[model samples]
Target: MKKLDVTYSANIGSYLGVPIILEDNTMFGTLCAIDPSPHKFDKKDLELMQTLANFIANAIELGQAYEIILAEEQRVKKELELAKKVQTSVLSEPVQLEKINIQAYYQSSESLSGDMYSWFEISPNKFGVILIDVMGHGVSAALISMSIRSLLKGLITSISEPIEVIKELNHHIFSLFNSTHQSTYATAVYMVIDTELKTIEYVNAGHPSGLLFLDQKTMKRMDEGSIILGIFPNLKVDKQLIHYNEPSTIMLYTDGLTELINPVINDAIHTVENIIIGEPDNLQLIEEIKKEFVNGKTLKDDICLITVNVE
Candidate 1:
């Protein structure tokens, strides 16, 4: 006390204080009081001051904890936004060729999507298309989708067959999840089109079947495939080929579109089939489907749709 500098005032003569310490043995501040006259505090008075200091320390700790929680929440929110942007930017745009027309629509139940669709030209007349659904929602699923996109982009350059591409993807996903002791799965459909041959070769990995519309009155669904990817390393992917003699529309979609709840459309699949057969153009079909199934209500899962018209 003698070594410390004191500020003498006319009215204040004495001061009493107790250190406010946190649970981690860190000092937050001091609980202090001042008196106008020179005074000596009793043991009871000191005890009371200690109790008040403990209370102040607890309050300070709580405030700090709350700040940390708030910061974490904001960080998560920003990460989700960034994830959404990354996922959206990776989606393929509508492709128009001399003999083929492609259109796609995508929507997520949340800010991040697990569903993804992509298509690119494999050769001068050959094109590769894929649709995938990771078995979850939000950031984790979105990350997996992004990884799948990267893998597909690299694989498509070397592999021209849909079955071999799916096999490689399954092997990669299986190996990754097995090493981490985590179980994650995804359903996918991949198709490769040869314009010169007028044929489509495709493989489905536990996803819903894609429809082949021969005309307004004739249609068929491609339903042959294997189990979901990442379930096992040794998956037998069956590849199917179809030769189209005339112009046809092939539609691929996630289960979210087939499971939508609409009062007017009792069966979502039937509604989609009706639109594909009835609508004259792809844009009208897309707009009509959105109006019927997705305009007003929140989706229960991520929705992805891809239509390829071969002429």
Candidate 2:
């Protein structure tokens, strides 16, 4: 075990003339053969011992490095799974509501997403729908969207007005980010549809303007909300009242749908017109809208579409 210079071989058992390297990087004294006749060991045997020591050192280093990498990978995967659960929970669980027929879609650019949709029946005839897009994508944005969703569900229950809901949600979100200095915000559209009265009430807050498909050849963009949410406090949202005279299709969506850089928004509007132009049916129009967005092409951001069919 001693790491002395080329000296004191006899004291450390050099009977066989075989040299050994200790695990602690120190060379052990040699052990020579026990034959009566004098014999000398070759240089090749010493070289082999040196090579074996190097291999052991390398194996230990590699094993430690591999474990470190695997640990990191598992940590990331667990975080991602948690985020997915949160995102999915933010959506309507059953995906079906009474009186108001809903069709919506969401696509994310990564494992975690920034887009979210929340909807519930306010009454037997009235339904509230909210679609939102946080500033960025992935875990941070998804968590923020989830918070907004929970806050809205609580806020909307007491308040049926879209404008008031946005104003309150904005203040809550702004206060949250101010404490953290995150500077995050969301673009949203809140719509309240009354089937009995046959009207659509909306409060837009810096969202992509929506389009109302009146007939096969006509469609009008509805984009009259105030500033984006989470930016200012007590801001007023523009309210629009859409009167549905007959059984027609109404489209409300996130910016990802129209602005995917595919120029499909215009075509999408035209497509809606083609299907429901002359006389639109509720069931038939929803099928066409789903076929347009869900098939053939993929969306870059979260794409959500909610359609109301007036009976």
| C-alpha lDDT values of all predictions | 0.84, 0.70
With a 3 Å backbone cut-off (N, CA, C), the pairs that clash in candidate 2 are 14-32, 15-32, 16-31, 16-32, 16-33, 17-31, 17-32, 18-31, 215-277, 216-277
What stretches of model 1 exceed 4 Å from their correct place?
Answer: 1-18, 32-49, 262-266
Q: Which tens-of-lDDT digit does each residue in 112-164 have in candidate 2?
A: 88788888878778888888888877888887887787787677777979888
TM-score on alpha carbons, each prediction: 0.81, 0.73
> Looking at model 2, which ten-residue stretch has the lowest summed lDDT?
7-16
lDDT digits (tens) for residues 105-197 of candidate 1 = 999999998899999889888999999999899888888888889888778868868889999889877886897889899999999988889
As a whole number from 0 to 100, the lDDT of residue 106 in candidate 2 is 59
On TM-score, the leading prediction is 1
Clashes of each: 0, 10
Tell me the deviation in Å of residue 171 in model 1: 1.5
lDDT of 2: 0.70
